[model samples]
Target: MLKPVAAIAALAMIAACGGSGADESTPPEVTAAPAATPAPVAASTPAPAPVAVAPGEPSPEFASLPAPYNAANYAIGKRTFKLCQSCHLTAEGAGNLVGPNLHGLFGREVGSLPGFAYSDALTNADFIWEPHHLDEWLTNPRAYLPGNRMSFAGVRKPADRDALIAYLMLETGYTSAEGDAPNE
Candidate 1:
């Protein structure tokens, strides 16, 4: 009885692996072992260097703002960023959490912040942290880099990504001097 069950199981495994088509004369093919499954984008990876800010850094409260800075989309983005809060910190002096602090995130090199030990994939990334790149990354992090270690499934909606980036630009290490207008 056990022998019959084992035979059935083996047959099922072969069928699942697509083994039914070959002829008796054909030689068996060898394939490489599969690589590890990529982690989700929302998950945190390691960063090496020690940060200046403490884990729970305090920031000053701001009064009401004017115009584009206070746009509705920006508000939406702030809400969207809540999804990222578990891994990253937005306060000016906040230290690293599961991921790095996002205080002055834009215009900086990817994975270049000192004190955080970054995975080789991120540390070797050549691009700077611009809006477009951020969009691609947020769309699907595992697709972006198959083996880097972020684990949260990415945000699929374009609108959500847009709002989140807008918020990050405004709230994370933004200076009043760098107004919303593009630099000539």
Candidate 2:
């Protein structure tokens, strides 16, 4: 009885100190609390820094465009493109976002990309994409084609429209053929 009471008091002391009452020589039970091991530190690799383009120098992406569209206007277009980035992707194999991926857009028929779901107005329209048509469409999408689904309020400035069209031409891989002239 006295030995059992002594064991109980030892357990009480161990419990107060947040320890198991088992002797140090005794092996811990399978259910015993595990000894804490420090979490392994993850080896972080730094992300590659963005390539900086010099002022007045055209970026490699815009280098192939004609003189006026290649340098200063390309820069403006690139800046303006930020507004469209939320919906569109210009890379050739990139997946569609809110709008369809715009690679090979210049000669493509309106709403003709295979996987994208276009509105009935676009799907039924007979026009191919061209700079002037794009300009009018960007001027006011809703007014240009009533019942179309683009939510942009339209680029009001003609210069901005020009820049944006030139940027899209370069980014979407337009190559000049006989009929593929920029709007004067």
Candidate 3:
């Protein structure tokens, strides 16, 4: 009776250790706890920086327009603006679509859309949408305004852009076909 009691006591002691010590040859069942944390080492390097603006105010991509309005150039601007009309409205206070109202937009301050949210791309983009600035944007809107939501491929031809910009200036009352200020 004493020997049996001793064997039972030894078995209880082995179980208390949390490791099964039934026999020297018997394998113990140990459940590993799940690793709840990730390693501290960074798996990948950060992404490259963005290239958007010039060093100073809109690095003179387009020199301010020369004195005389080039009829020929304005014609080109008119045609170029047709492409812009697809995304932008040409009427004053028109409804917003992909972009804001462009009527009287030439001299308007940037990011003043009544209800539309402009991309940071447009607000920070130096230079008003003047004839010269529009020319560059129509040339390549994506490059001109990186991260701009408008997905225009941009007009490639200078003559075409000039015609379109001329029209925009005239329509927006920013300049005349002769490059004079619009008649008040």
Give TM-scores for every candidate, taking all chains together and pairing residue i with residue i.
0.55, 0.62, 0.52
Candidate lDDT scores, in order, read 0.68, 0.79, 0.60
Model 1 regions lying over 4 Å from their true place? 1-72, 175-184
- Model 1: per-residue Cα lDDT over 120-180, one tens digit each: 8898788777666677789898888666678878888766776676667656865443233
lDDT tens digits by residue: candidate 3, 1-184: 8999999998899788865745657666799999889769888999644323422222121234432233335434544567677778877667877888778766566667678898898777655445556666677878977888878888876556554655565455464333233222
- Report residue 145 deviation for candidate 2 (angstroms): 1.3
Candidate 1 lDDT for residue 69: 28
| Winning candidate number (lDDT) | 2
Model 2 residue 177 CA deviation (Å) reads: 3.0
Q: Whose TM-score is higher: candidate 2's or candidate 3's?
A: 2
lDDT, residue 65, candidate 1 = 28
The true-versus-predicted C-alpha distance at residue 90 of model 3, in Å, is: 1.3
Worst 10 residues of 1 by lDDT: 54-63
After superposition of all CA atoms, the RMSD between model 2 and the true structure is 7.6
What are the per-residue Cα lDDT tens digits for candidate 2 across 1-184?
Answer: 8999999999899888978746768776678688899999889978644246664455555556654445436566777888899999999999899898989988889989999999998999888887767878989999998889899998887667767878898778897644455566
